[model samples]
Target: MPEVKSQVDPSDASPFTRVRQLAQRAGLDGFLLALLGAILLAYLWPHFGSDDGPLPLNQIANYGVSIIFFFYGLRLSPEKLKAGLSNWRLHLVVQTTTFLVFPLLLIAARPFFDTGNQKLLWLGGFYLAALPSTVSSSVVMVSIAGGNLPAAIFNASISSLLGVFVTPIWMALYLPNGGHNSSLWGTIGNLALQVLLPVVVGVLLHRWLSAWAKRYDKQTRYLDQSIILLIVYTSFCESFYRGIFQGYQLTSILLLGVLLLALFFGVYAWILLVSKVLGFEKGDTITALFCGSKKSLVQGTVMSKVLFPDARLAGIVLLPLMMYHALQILIASIIAQAIGRRAAPEVPVPEPVAGT
Candidate 1:
């Protein structure tokens, strides 16, 4: 008999290890917990992250946003983006589902939330709907499900760029009387400076810097997470200091959570059916599902600061987005793993030997 190695059985693991394993299987990220922790910290000590606070957190977060997009652009290749565009049919479906289908679904839900706190929650949902697909999560989910990575990357990149303009336009159209109407052009200009400009500069330097950016991808991700936590903390700091989140009860918040999940599944079902109707290959279907259904919390967070004018309002806008971001990650991770397992090709069984 062969000697056994020193492997430990999972059942023999400690409680903490078992919990960690369960979390990993469920696709839970520590960042999500950190996000909630940031909010809690903000609630407890709002002044630390506020405008007059010693830290100047908002400004730091703003600068970090620029660096995030710049590094994003630096890591991508113009040639690859072009190459990924060859599938016009797939591209059209993905983009249409992203910009048109997602927002329209929310627009249809506006009537149900015309009064009170519901309206604010509904507005947040609409904003999320209008936002672009996420870059990393969409691509990661698609890749796990055996989708076309090139197309996922291209669609995600293009979607972020498009959202810089499109999200503002959607807000302008929907909020004409909400004080943000006339400022659409101004908002776009600010985004151009903070978002578009950095991306353009990064792309220009991609040939020289792409390798360095890729080499330090893990570090960059940590920096991105830190910046996001800072942004969330500062935003909620202003909200708590101003007493914005106190108006709604916990039940209302829970209701919004339920509604957001409905929104996700509604979109997912639509994409699942339509991709089949369009005769999408497995990869294309996977890409369409993931890329089409995602919302970009990164872009949403940065843009909320520019769009809301008030930090408290920005915090309100981010509420649904933060919840949706967590929910989508969990559900999508499960789906991706399931699809990966089921979609794998079966190994061929060998025929019986004639001699036997």
Candidate 2:
């Protein structure tokens, strides 16, 4: 047996290695694919509901963010609060970027949106800017990069919590097309019921549910992704059904894509520069830069009804969110990996010292 052994190349062998390789291979971004799928599903949504009734599928899509948040609470431990308290500076930078700088950038770019369609596009960007930082992906990036897991988790969760309030306030200040006449208190109730309530329930039961959450986390992630894709498809489908693109052209979308890419990279670069100037180490800077720049799709969707009740304008409001989410994931994933490689040699002591 030893004499007859055949050698396997390191890159060509092992299931774990192969799976990671496959994941790393370039393809259409998963979020983009999910969005496209959601659009197709949305197109078919109205058919399932009624002649003039809400599509059951679209209704299901509406709960996507809540479901995601519930699963989030189930997974996150109460320990996160303690962790959040420990890294005040990192949390400070991330929160400032998410709640302050991002929105400011969106506001500054408003003057350039002159075209009738351009305003909608700019509003979309602004809506995206108002949303909070993401939780899962940012933590994943930080963990993979060997940056700081506790800090990432803390900042990400706090950002989501903060977004529940900040997103609406920013909309009141900057969102242009006007849909704010709805009962603000009722909207708050809707947010509490749909988003925060489930999370609160899950957090309350986390002691009993932690093991279950850990076991089913992968399944829950799939569910989250599937629901989001459904939302994207259904939303776009409604646009198609309503002839939403009657005047909107491919050129406009293309231009918007370029602009979105610029916005993501520009904010990311700014964060990196700021973190460096502030004297953060490489790992903390990497974590800060990623955590600061990304926006939350879940937050945007859940908050939009309150922020922009005019369903006519809601889709445009979501455009920037959709674009930014996709771009940030792809760009940040690459940058995180590169940073991980560069910082590998300098990573702190993997195992703690003996006897404390």
**Best candidate according to TM-score:** 1
lDDT tens per residue, model 2, 4-107: 86788877778977764454432234445656566555556634422244546656766676787788778768887775697788888899988888888878
Off by over 4 Å in 1: 1-6, 175-182, 345-356
Q: lDDT of each structure?
A: 0.82, 0.70
How many clashes does the backbone of model 1 have? 0
Clashing pairs in 2: 38-232, 38-233, 38-234, 39-232, 39-233, 42-233, 42-234, 43-237
Error of 1 at 241 (Å): 0.8
Compare the candidates by lDDT and give the number of the best one. 1
Candidate 1 lDDT tens digits, 1-356: 99979999999999999997677666565777788999999989998898868987898888988987788788768998898878888888888888899889888888998776678788888889889989888887887778998999999888988998899888876653556434779778888888889999999999998888889988987887788888889999998888877779899899999999998998899988988998999899999998888888888887777777677666777899998988888888888877777877452211110000
Question: Candidates' TM-scores?
Answer: 0.92, 0.83
Off by over 4 Å in 2: 1-23, 27-32, 40-55, 63-65, 174-183, 305-309, 345-356
Candidate 1, overall lDDT?
0.82
**What value does the lDDT take at residue 30 in candidate 2?**
47
